[model samples]
Target: MTVYDNCHLGHARAMMAFDILARYLRFQNYKVNFIRNITDIDDKIIERANENKETIDALTGRTIASMQEDFAMLGLELPTHEPRATDHIEGMIKMIGTLIDKGHAYHSAGGDVFFAVRTFPEYGKLSNKNIDDLNPGSRIAEDESKKDPLDFVLWKSAKPNEPSWDSPWGPGRPGWHIECSVMSLENLGKHFDIHGGGPDLLFPHHENEIAQSECASDHKFANYWMHSGLLKINGEKMSKSLGNFAMLKDLFVSYHPEVIRYYLISSHYKSSLNFDSDSLDQARSALTRLYQAASLVPLQESDLHEDSVKGFIDSMNDDLNTPEALSILFGLAKSINSTQDAQDQSMYASTMKELGKVLGLLNDSSEAFLQYGADLTDEEISQKIEERNQARNNKDFLKADQIRDELVSQGILLDDSSDGTSWKKS
Candidate 1:
């Protein structure tokens, strides 16, 4: 669960993929110590900070806070540990020293250090790529001072006014890939349960990490490697250059949080999710039915009934099949809506809650959520109630009906009882 917020809270597709894997691991009773590292001191961070006329600390801090807020809105739990690259300089330096001692890294004349990719026998095992076949492209250039063109930098020579740390190599900072190696080793030990990120990291970033960690510790880095698919906008890769990238904060203003969450989770973890306003609207409408059904049923504690909830659990267990699980939930919602018996409705309600506990959806009532942005004052609602009561008492059915219609249009539902009239948000 190592996420790099290179642009922001990351693409929604990446977050959904992590959420599914985390939920599935927890369901299977695994003590998963998930750690998502933050590359707070990257080249991009410095560039963005400079463009905004802000300090590096301020840029990273604000983006991290916004990322946490997005995670909360999606109902995602925080990672066990969040290590920032700037905060773990000591740990990174220690690991780099170990690599240098093990002859896996070398120092250049200009005070820059690079990893010796040729020294590692299984260099491209994780990515299943051959060093001979790797097209260096623009990533590798002719720096005659270096041993090999393919070898990437382990420590960079700092420039004036840029962030730097004191190291044996020189007064420089750790490379982008080294940060994860150090953070993972410090937080989750040399060998951890799982390592995950976007599919794009499988190449240079993750491959380089393997080279550094295994060479330093002489042990496996992660038992399992998982990666989520990239997000596209309308069948095209999202990029700032193309002007197709959508900001998470901008989208949040127009769409409900649950709607966006549903859209992200509807597709499989390893599949690309093409984001659009229409698709999100469809997800919102689909989830609205579940919320509407849940609203009709009275609230009750979840009851354990494995037999009835097995479909939902089985779908989730099969590599977190959220689409299938949602289908099962829809079927249950239909059952609740079509049934009339009081006892059956109560049983259905309990079953729905039990299923919702696993899916992390349909847990909130429609009434409660629809009241998210109401401008009406409490006194106004009370006055309307009083007027409705007065109309009913005076036997003016037409006037009472008009008032009730106005309330309904404003997302309020009124139920008339013999004793009085009760109201709730529609």
Candidate 2:
């Protein structure tokens, strides 16, 4: 996780998706040593610290603390090893030295070290792009110090008044790409089972890491790559510029973190999740329904339905197909809800909660989930009012009226006029 800023919804999506995956693996009795790296030192961190007029440590420390708080609140299981980049600088420097010793990398006259991309015959294999295609018509402006335009920086040259470390290539820091290779190598060895990240990293960041690591370490790396899809607002990418940027902190104020997790994992992990109030609405409804089933029968030991258990496992085994797994969970819930047979209800409820643990859902008591989960915070009510106004402005009357009805169902009456809508709770 980058320590430059607050973790947004996108960050939460990737982290939660992996968190459930790790849970399932452990449930399946696999020894999973999950290592999530913290990038404390980077160009972004430096720039952000300078902008905030704070020391790098101060900025990163605060951000890391906040990230931990947010993760804990979301009930994300802690990683087995959380290695910070600054803590592994020596590993990075040693790897850089190894790359330089090989014919795969070179030192620039400008005191920077760069990976010689042309030397690596399989440079574009991971990204599936031809080198000729990437550099077609001088598309990318080459850095004069770089041997080739595609050759990324391994160790950037130190500048005045910036953070620096004593390296063979003068005093400088490791580039973003080199940090991951070093951290992963240090934690998981030359070849690990899985390397996971957001889809955006596939191109340059991941592709560069592959080239640098393989060339440095006998052409070996992670065996499998898992890329999570993006989280967007409405249908477009969430950005501050797009006026749709959201922070997880703000969302937590409105909805429970578990609800957010449910919303995030409702769709398949590999598919993009379009987040909005409507999506959250569905997530809450579904989670409550599951909780409702668990509430139907007393919590006790009962034989789980073999078919439902097998179905859940099958769906999850199929590349974490959470949507199918959720349907199976709902099927159990439906059995409990539709039946008056106490023994059958107990059996289904036991199975529902048992399977739900793998996905980090259905832990809450039915009474609490039904009551607290339905209640909106004051901030959430205000936010809902704003969304309703937005819907009205766009002439989406159906959606506008729906938001109003949802708020009203919460026992909050709205007074509307030219002055705008104001809410009063009775």
Candidate 3:
């Protein structure tokens, strides 16, 4: 994740998708070495720091802390090695030198180094675009220093008051593309099992990484690439102009983090997710049903691996079909609801949670999760229930009804059985 600004739902979706993948893989007994890189030094990071009147280190440090806090709240797994781009500049310089030596890169007259797209025949292999048909940003535009519009900067010439590192191409920091190329090769070796990011990275960012890494190392960069689908806002692309752009911090004020996660994984990872208030409300209702069912069960181990659990594993094995996996879990919840047998409900709930662990959810105590956003504390709720009971015992039907209605307004539902009264979040 980049450290230029606060993390938003788009960031959360991509992160949660990958985190779920890692958890499922580990659940299957696979050793997962997950590496989520931090792009600490970027053009936007610099611009934002300057705008905030803070030093670059101060800006990035604060943002990284905020990112960590947000991810942890969403229950994302920490990466095995979280390498910052700034920490891998020396490796970037070494790789740039190698590319230059191999005639795939050149230093321009402006004291900048650029990768020659013409020199690498597989320049557009990842994006599957013709070199002539490509339309990159102004950074790759035809210029005096850049021989072709397709050529991209490996190292930039130092500008006034900008960060720089001493290199053969003079004192300038690495460009955006070179950071991942060098960092991935340095940590995961020249070749790795998988490379992943959001679908937006599949274009110039990933294409450039491919060209530069392969040309420099003379080998395949990654065996496979996995990109999660893009997220949208109510059938429209997210933009500040749309007035629907949201940040995770802002959304967390209204919805539970686990609700957000459940909503994100409700669709296939490769399918576009449309975010709206209604979708989140539905997600909350669905999760509430699971917790309500679990409340009837006593905690126990699920070594039996019931049919629903097998179905969940099947769904997940089919390319992480989370929507179907969730459906299977809901099936178990259905069994718990339909049956009066205590042992059956306990078995189903236990299996449901065993599957939920793969999705990083449903482990919370039933009362805690069910009453997650309730206005009253547990003690307060219990006191209210007792007051209502006393009112009923005194034959004050009006007083008892009033208390019950007030608690319902605060999302505390009451169940009056022959024995006594019990309360739960609505």
Candidate 4:
């Protein structure tokens, strides 16, 4: 199984969703080979590069690097192979040649090659659409050259000053749909366990892949098809035109990446996740409580007691039900917080850590996470502490308690030990 990341480039939600699935599959003792293809050569990439006066290589390279950083921050294991569309041009050419030889594709006089949808017997199985009901889009213009209007392009004829590659027809590039078909076949063979992407790609992109690959290989394409729902902001769909699309870098400036990951995973993968500052803030507070409980327990190197942690594994194994898994984790956290016994706390903490490994959250110290921003200066905190001490010395307990309360509100917890007073982030 593999999750495509074209639209969710900077967002870690897509990767986290698949991580939960992959971990669950591993827990079930299945050897899954996942392959996620990077569309390095797309019309959007070229258009964005031109608008920014940058080259396509520079744009894709920078975005790919940022993607890697985001993936690391989200704790996603790398896929078996990260194939680039441009890197597999040779494979695409061979596949296209096979389709032409099999009489499933034809070339136009303008050097553009298109797939003959009527030639394929199982053209609409994946999409469950009849050939007569298919309509033409802006891309499928009224061309007398095409045998059928439903036939999509396999290769686009390159114009002057555009990216071009030598093919049997002429100098042109591969279409958007053909890249995935060729890349997946080249890396994972004709049939694979699963194929995934955003819900929007289900119509043309994935549908066309099914048509081309099956017609060429005379075998199935993928065993299962998985898709993630679109992200929304508040009640509106996130889009560049609305100026409501939040970039991952900008969101990480004030919020921790883990908080964002938690917010994204809180809902089911197939459900629409509404983004808002309040949602992230709630996630932050929830994680803080979990981490605080984790901090109270000591770290253990012992293996997890499966009988005790069976609920967590069960929730995760049943179609990767992360929301239920989170509820189990929260229950464990509550148990740890309510315990007064030292040995029980230790056992609960160890169990919490192992279960957290599956969810890919709560893997950090409470102190470090609370002190994420260097906004508060040491001298300022010292001055506040001095004022509070002065209040206490004057027997004005009310003022001292107020000052301490203010500090705690800022995520600074105060503790008075036999040695002296100490402060830590809550």
Candidate 5:
């Protein structure tokens, strides 16, 4: 499950990664129950709400809607269940009670309840770090009332003018870690096939979830863990202080959402993807190649190459190696372009589109994808092509060349054939 607080491209990478996995699993005939949770209430939500001078619901609601829109823009499949942290408060309260009863948690003199990390012997198993190796006071939040510095809070005491909910201990909210644990367990039960999130969450956030859930239920947590690597701006980590962070909406103004999705999926999910103009240009160029080849062949309802589909499924099965899968796609596109046989071209195009659909690419018409984000419409380009043809027919070679050059300047490439003229965005 993923969390949301001003969701960015980094978050989109993780979402797309799991989305592809879910899609592939369903394609493989698995009954996949994908769940992505929204962290509606948290320290960040409170801080942002107070700063914006708005109610928590108002801020969270707006942000959540915007996030959903962004996900759809990137072609992400909606999850099976999307639970908000606030909606599962009763389950959180009950889980915290179980932890306290199980001696894995305690209420401090202050209203907060803290988890006893030392009691959980396998606390650092996921991260593979020893408790003794941890810096004496490193990574632990500053809270003086806790018995130990590493003991994280399960429930946070409400401060003045903060959002509060009814609880046995007092009016407070669950801590960040407890929210995911209760939500996942209540919805997916004690055991699920797999759990996934961003790499950063694996340490404290997911680590804490495992401890709390396992201790509370005396059952194992998720069988497998999947974490997508972080996204960087240029060559460095994206942070507000660095001034290199790019928001999703801002990127959409400069590039098509499909282009951004292509760039994000060009690399392996476990590898860091550096965002740069050149990388985006490469993605656009590559997608242009696929669309150009797609345009050469007529749209067929069914025509597939068994070998190509097998290669695609193999690459996807091998840990979802999308980069390799794309290589197969590009190779098929090359064959489609080189082939003169109409039947073979159609078969190649069908195989390419079928494989690309697995990765959510090439679904748009060639004209649509090629002309997207262009300054001129198809009719405008066609009219310009007609004028150029008339100029050529009148033996005005210079005028025809000039018209073609003008269209080229506008990012349109015109191809003159005996049949007529066809155009595409450069």
Candidate 6:
């Protein structure tokens, strides 16, 4: 789980999706060792730093801090180990030397060391595609510097004014793919349980990692590989050129972080997620129902709903089918709302909260969630409700209805119960 760039919703979808799996495994009493690496040094980071007229350290330091903040806002459980690529440069250099010694890599006349894709007969094993079928754009230019067109760089030669590290090949930096292989090997060892990332990494990135790592270690790189599906904004790929690139913090101005998290996990991890206001509103409404039901039960710990918990576990086991797992929560929520017995309500609420915790959700108090980020404060809404009650008592029904309508227009839904009126954000 190595993240780069501004850490947008696409990153959030993957992070939260994996977090759900990690938290679930932990709940099941499985000790999960989740190692998410950070790619601090890359061509993109260098370009951005130069464009912003800042030192590389200044840029990466700021961006990494901001990335951590964004992850916190999304309620992501921190990984067990988070190694940065720059911090593992020595290990990366050592691995590259091993590749060269094993004849899996070559140091070119141009001073760049490249992994010989042809040497690794299983080059396309993970991607399940032939190198000849790959688009020419996927590889570097077919220059004399590389032994073959498919050969990917392990060490990139330094350009003037660019960041580089002293390596056996020369004063150069590790290539993008090699960084992950080295970092993963360093933190989780040569053979770990799982390797995962966004779907885009399934091809050249992960494939290259597999090629380099297994070639060096002579053992399996990972027992399993998992990749989350792509996230699109309004059915279009989010790109700056398309004017659809969305920053996660910018989304927070209108939607709560929890709402965004729910929207992300509403779909299966391997299925595409379309980011749109309609989808977000639906998630918001769904979450509100769960919170409303949760508010009914007396706040006390109770045993989980056995049946729903089983359903959730089954869905998650079946390749992280979050949509089906979420259905279990919705069903539990419906039961909580329909049941009249206080004990039953408490049981249902407890189950929902405990299960939702695995998905990084439903932890907030129901009232807190309903009133979170509302335009009107608790005191303000209470004052207005009191004023409306007085209006109704004075036989000013029209004024009371008007006040209710006004609140509704402000995205507040007021429900009149026998006890009193309760409100939630629409």
Q: Rate the local accuracy (lDDT) of all candidates.
A: 0.77, 0.84, 0.86, 0.77, 0.86, 0.85
Global CA lDDT of candidate 2, please?
0.84
Off by over 4 Å in 5: 1-6, 239-242, 376-403
Candidate 4 backbone collisions, by pair: none
Lowest-sum lDDT 10-residue window in model 3: 236-245
**Residue-level error in angstroms, candidate 2, position 16:** 2.0
Candidate 4 residues lying further than 4 Å off, grouped into runs, are 1-11, 138-144, 302-308, 377-426
Off by over 4 Å in 6: 1-5, 389-402, 416-421
lDDT tens string, model 5, 224-265? 999998888867766544667777887776567788888888
Model 3 residue runs over 4 Å out of place are: 137-142, 239-243, 376-383, 417-426
Candidate 5 lDDT trough over 10 residues, lowest sum: 1-10
- Quote each prediction's TM-score: 0.86, 0.86, 0.94, 0.88, 0.93, 0.93
* Per-residue lDDT of candidate 4, residues 96-160 (tens digit): 89999999999977678999989987777787978777777654577777878888888888886
Model 3 C-alpha lDDT versus the unseen true structure: 0.86
Clashes of 3: 0
| Model 3, span 1-426: residue lDDT tens | 779788888888788889999999899999988888999998889999999999999999999999999999898988999999999998999999999999999999888899998998877887788887777664355567787768888998889989999998789998999999887888889889889889888988998999999888889999988899878987876644456678888877666788888998999988888887688889989998888888887887645446787788899999999999999888888998999987777788888888888898897787677667676888898888888789888999899899999998878888878867776666
Model 2 weakest 10-residue run by lDDT: 366-375
Model 6 poorest ten-residue lDDT run? 1-10
Candidate 3 lDDT at 140 equals 51
Cα error, candidate 1, residue 188 (Å): 0.7
